[model samples]
Target: MTASPSSAYPYRLRLPGPITIPERIRQATARSIVNHRGPEMRVILEEIQQWIKPLFGTTAPVLTFGSSGTGVMEASLANVLAPGEKVLALVHGQFGERYAQIARALGAEVDVIESEWGWTPDPAVIAAKLDKNDYRALVAVHNESSTGAVTDLAAIGALLRDRDTLLLVDSVSGLGGLELRQDEWGVDIIVTGSQKALMCPPGLGFASVSEKARKVIERDDRCARFYLDMRKALAVVDKHETAFTCPVSLLFGVHEALTMIHEEGLPQVFARHKRLSDAMRAGCVALGLPAFGDQATASHTVVVASVPEPLTGGAIVKHMYETYNTAIAGARNKLTGRVIRIGTMGLISEADVLTDLYFLERSLTALGHAVPTPGCGVAAAVASLS
Candidate 1:
């Protein structure tokens, strides 16, 4: 009999993520299953709790759940902000809107400050709004992956300082790849996933809650959610445990990934991302392709460039996969057919970026799309490493 389809390697990917995983992390996660509540699991959870705090830059309570980043989005609004309270959602792209949606669904009155599709939220705009109104909390996405822009967190955070209002951030794609200081930045709640910068498969959602946010969670009696309740989770965490069945394998992967990040040193990791991002954009410039958003606010974790005339992003995505054995992403939601995206996170090396660009140049040329400047794309990209 022929081999099963699952037996073969799927797409050869250079995704905007769930990107490639490292060998060491894969090996660590492959161990035989262990009892979720046993002593073995206890050791793992405790270790993760201590280690993950540094990444978050939080001395506050950092919690892990076996759900996606959206889960924490729900938990944050549901547990802390009471019904009928007002929340200001600063939205630039898709993920920022997601924060507002979750808050609205959970009964908080959402006041949204929206910008153009490819523009990041102006901290000045948000600050002006704050001065005129009283809000229970401010919700923002640290990185807007869909439009490839990053919000100004430092400016936003500074505005909220020492105030009654709390700050919630979705750092789903930024946490492990970018520099985020939870406590220093005065971010009350920060959430992320294992799939993005952490260099692991999707399954784990990590969040950090400040003492001020925890008190709000503790006192909210009107809406009692058991499964995703921060207080309930924290009680068990006190014993280094989970309130529900956890993904044991994913926990292992997260631990190893975090260990690898610290070993490399965060400063080095950050510098590497900056280099790769600059190179990717330079390549885009060389190819005469416009990136989706403003360069000033572009994300360090993702790059989105406009597809030239005579081809949609989806078509190019397909062509690149079939003809070149690579997989980058096409646009999603409102931006579909307009732009192509590349992930610059989680084990994607400078060399990998170069290889992807080389093939990208070839694929675009194969599609009858002329390279604006022959060899310019690769040259500018390669120079960024030096």
Candidate 2:
């Protein structure tokens, strides 16, 4: 029988996220509750804004959501764009399409600029799409996590900076881990989750909004959302409180996680993630598994590699998780058994990468693939790190 949810599974790690939290943050998550409206909580809230601002590249206070990153994406759409406004939602993967779905559900006339699963939406193509339609906003994912494809937001931003449309970015997996400058990129709205690169478990999410988007939200009386109304939520910003009761425990954990990020420094933190990603890509190369896309657009967050003929992604994932108890993510839904997705997103070092590589090589070998050089994958990875 499988281990119970609460039971400790026999694995070195479980996931890229809900990733192994530092012991201190884990303890903080379990700490005694504080009143969400109390003075102590106010201090925590104030500190969180200060702690999180640099990550989002915003001087304006970031809005916190008591849900997943998708929640923030939906909330952002609901709060800013009104009914009948056209939104160009770029789709390169599942999450990108998700943003489109949310827009469609909310009555926005959605136009999609789609690319193949393993490729990122081209900025020039997107720029042309914008010119063809008088779009109110452009919804794009900075890093297409589902396919391990990274979009060129900087180039996209350069094209749109002087345009009339707003740029709403879903940087859920890219924000803290990858290089993202919301303000510098002229991203009107940016959303991210706590689980990915924040070194915390999933629980809360937040959005950083620019002045233009804030005004658009303030003036869009047609927007009927109550809970996600940034106007309502920001009403008490000076008081360091939210529109509703906040999750104090998750806030504690996020704050602790942000503290850890600060300790590492953002530049070094991003570099560490890059190092881990490089090692992962190198190891995959040594295993004779080609990456899903070229290195230029590859995600620093995760490595998506094509599963060779006769070696199903399902079998390897099953063997890794069930037999070795080392969990790695699989493909985007449509091509489930065709590709394997592995993440080095949060709280992982070279040692962790080595361990995961060892398991992946062994899993492939056990499944009848030839590892011409038994330890080469790990060696390549280690050399990349050094």
lDDT string, candidate 2, 251-341, tens digits: 9998898888899899998898899999998998899788886678888888888888898888888888876778787764887887887
Tell me how candidate 2 scores on lDDT.
0.84
Highest TM-score scorer: 2
Q: Which stretches of candidate 2 lie over 4 Å from their true place?
A: 1-9
The CA lDDT at 151 in model 2 is 85
Candidate with maximal lDDT: 1
lDDT per prediction? Answer: 0.84, 0.84
Q: What C-alpha lDDT, on a 0 to 100 scale, does residue 97 get in candidate 1?
A: 85
